[model samples]
Target chain A: MGLIQREIERAGIATIGISIVREFTEKVQPPRTVFLRWPFGHPLGEPGNSAQQRAVVLEALRALYQIEEPGTIIDLPFRWRREKYADYLPPTAADLE
Target chain B: MDVTRFKNRTLARLATRFPRLAQRFIDGYQAQESAGSIPWAVPKPLRQAKLALVTTSGIHHQRQAPFDMNDSDGDPSYRTLNGEELFDDFQITHDYYDHTDARKDPNIIFPLGPLRELVSEGLLGRLAQTHYAFMGHIDGRHIPTLVEKTAREVAAKLKADQVDLVLLTPA
Candidate 1:
């Protein structure tokens, strides 16, 4: 969350945040941000996909070094395979509300 | 009609329709009654002492556009809290109500008002000049990257200002 990162940063420690949605974070305006195009809840991917999750987390940690200024955003280059999971049903708008 | 039977029938129907919801309700209820009996990691005192609050409620200045609720379906990665000014006219637009409402109170989500109170009482060193917020249901791939980048930048500024602890409140 932007607030957690902000708090950590405010405490004189370095922080970074990865987000799936850009609009809300854009408002909070943390120093550095990365956007990924994936469904909600499972930020790193399916629960068992440790390999993919670790890779994504490592990439996010790496972004901290690349960003030098506040309000910088980058879109990661990754895609989720539809065939990877047959039970994958992303939440719908009605379900969310 | 027996009252016990009526209650049991109602609960059975509810569970059939929303099994996860029913489970969560039972879990939370039991957790509350048990109080501190469950084992979980207790957070250490923040070495970096500057404190901040985070909310998933997609709260923003009324002037700003709200987070895209339509983006993620059932398992929304992001969570929103209707706290601060953003919740003055807040509305739910997602199905994952448990995460969103787990600690639904505004004071719990956005503790700025209380932080200021602490400052007045000298309970804390000081509140960060600014706080942060986000939409909770973010996809994981993007979160690590975006959160890290923003945190690093914000940390630099906070360090420059001599802040020491950060209190993270996730909704």
Candidate 2:
């Protein structure tokens, strides 16, 4: 996934990846990433959990704008099936800027 | 199914159910590490950027041919996804992971629904009508093909679509 992401970023499109395997992400080194210690096939979060999914989307987008140095991977703090996401405040336009 | 396919599927289910087993599997595959400079693209503000998804989670339209699971080197080819109608007939092809949860709710891997909701709430700008999907287990001989051919092809397509930001998810 990081390999493909590198190509997309090289094409001048900003890229951020959600990585399940930290070892691969660290090796392939995409432009920006959010590393989650979640299970395989569950990069965003649990099935049918909209709030957790949205929180992840928000974090990736936030990392997209916030990460300046290339190849930076932010370790997300959400625990699989053990964390609550109802209070993940969506960043406003001003906050992003 | 052949012996290799059946083994891969069974192991995938085990890996998904057990992270330690997944780690052992991940450890066996030596992912190529970068040696030189990394590519960087300046990002625009989320509220004004046109976002697109690129998932290596083996998702494709049900009508489309599934990714080739026979190749142990893994399939480097990607499928073009139409955001509007993808969920109506979605299918997952890669045998590298247990997709029972993703099948129940694709947003766990694809996150398109959550992204659309963000757009609706005015937190995100707009989503590109098109996205991409690839089977993530490419290895050995297919690595060069992915780096030099198929991945570049998807990148060019994303460029043509004027996508400003991309979020990649893996299986």
Candidate 3:
């Protein structure tokens, strides 16, 4: 996704991207990005939350304005899933591997 | 298959909700998506620029052919959608993500309503003639082709439509 965003940016059209995975997006940065710690499918916020979605859209566009340099990623303060992220995270160095 | 070791219900639910992520974590591996270098494009004001959005949520017109889920490396194809299309004319076909909510409310994946409202409020530049969608699961050797070929194709389409800014929403 970041690759395609970079290609579009190279084509001379400024591009902004929203990513579910910040680590992955941070590696292959688009010209501008908004990193949201959200679910896989809902990039603009949860389903049916139009106001929050619109706010997200505004923030995404606002990211374009605030970022003067390329490859800048603005992390949105929003978060989803009240579960302990560490609990859901698979053990990196454990019996699983 | 073993739930005895995990105590958190949310964690167990997440494993079931997105099996791909769970599998990757179990394997202790994830894709290294790196373009190596950043590409810069001068941006115009949001108020008057021609804005466009591209989603990887498998949204396409009802008349168009759906994405090829049979491809192991996933589909690199993209479909064009205009603002004028009815909400009923679109559907999702990607197998990777959970689309139950998206199916219930397409705005979860595609923000046509919010975008149109932005236009109505004059909060953004005019929308371009077309928006785009591609299945998000494309990987393996097809990655480069998608980056090179399909990206150019979409960029050409955007250029022809005089789009100045593009917003990419990845599912």
Candidate 4:
């Protein structure tokens, strides 16, 4: 959670948050943020794709190094290649009723 | 083109086997979003900073205490994972997010592999001896306790370990 990140940063330790949902991360405004277009459960690419996962992590750390201003967010160019079913589905709007 | 998708913690595997449970998950998820505090602290360069990793992926070793899944509000607890431990020894107890891939390769949730590489390459300062993990489904209210208390404790541990930078991954 970005809240936790902020608390840790407040303690004088810098924090880099890698997360989904750009809007949530935007609201939290972590000192440094790396936004990924991946699904809910997987932040560093798919489950076993080590190369892609490492790339995502490296990008996050890279952002950590490059971001100088407070609340800087770097959107990762990576995409979740497979179908994401866990915790993500649109109910066609009418389903809420 | 006029669909509505919400941020949910999980669509249980049961949701697929039972189908009808998906809506409940959505309701639970939307209720979890919150307004987080903004705090900023600048640190030294990455190559000079002592690094640590924190994850909301519910990761823990079999020997450590497990997160309580029964708590609907969230476990609000934390675990310390030695960076040296084998990835095979760890397990995830979270139900909110899909763990299928995480079960196979932990980099999906905790990127210790890349972290180690970074440290060795001298791109990142040395790794902190410790790391942390907790379940990510806590509601907005229960979260402050985690942030104010548990996380502070963890940060203290990081401070004790002389860590300067933390990479937090949220699922």
lDDT of 3 by residue, B1-171 (tens): 134223322443464377565455434434545645688887787667888888887888888898887665788888989767747687877765666777788887777788788788766668876898888777787788888799889988898889999999887
lDDT, candidate 4, residue A17?
Answer: 92
Q: Show model 2 residue runs off by greater than 4 Å.
A: none
Summarize candidate 2's per-residue lDDT along B75-115 as a digit string, tens digits. 99999999999999999999989999999999999999998
Candidate 3 — which residues are off by over 4 angstroms? A81-97, B1-32
Ranking by DockQ: 2, 3, 4, 1
Return the lDDT, model 2, position B32. Answer: 86
- How far out, in Å, is residue B30 in model 4? 5.3
- Model 3 chain B lowest lDDT segment of ten: B1-10
Best by DockQ: 2
Scored against the native two-chain complex, candidate 2 gets a DockQ of 0.89
Q: What is chain B's TM-score across the candidates, in the order shown?
A: 0.50, 0.98, 0.82, 0.79
Candidate 1: docking tier: incorrect
After superposition, candidate 1 runs with Cα above 4 Å error = A1-11, A14-97, B1-50, B73-95, B98-105
Ranking by lDDT: 2, 3, 4, 1
Off by over 4 Å in 4: A82-97, B1-10, B13-37
Candidate 1 C-alpha lDDT tens digits along A11-65: 5454556665455456556556677655433344444454454445435434555
**Backbone Cα, N, C clashes tallied per candidate:** 53, 0, 0, 3
Model 4 deviation from the true structure expressed as Cα RMSD, one decimal place: 10.3
What is the TM-score of chain A, computed separately for every candidate? 0.76, 0.94, 0.79, 0.80
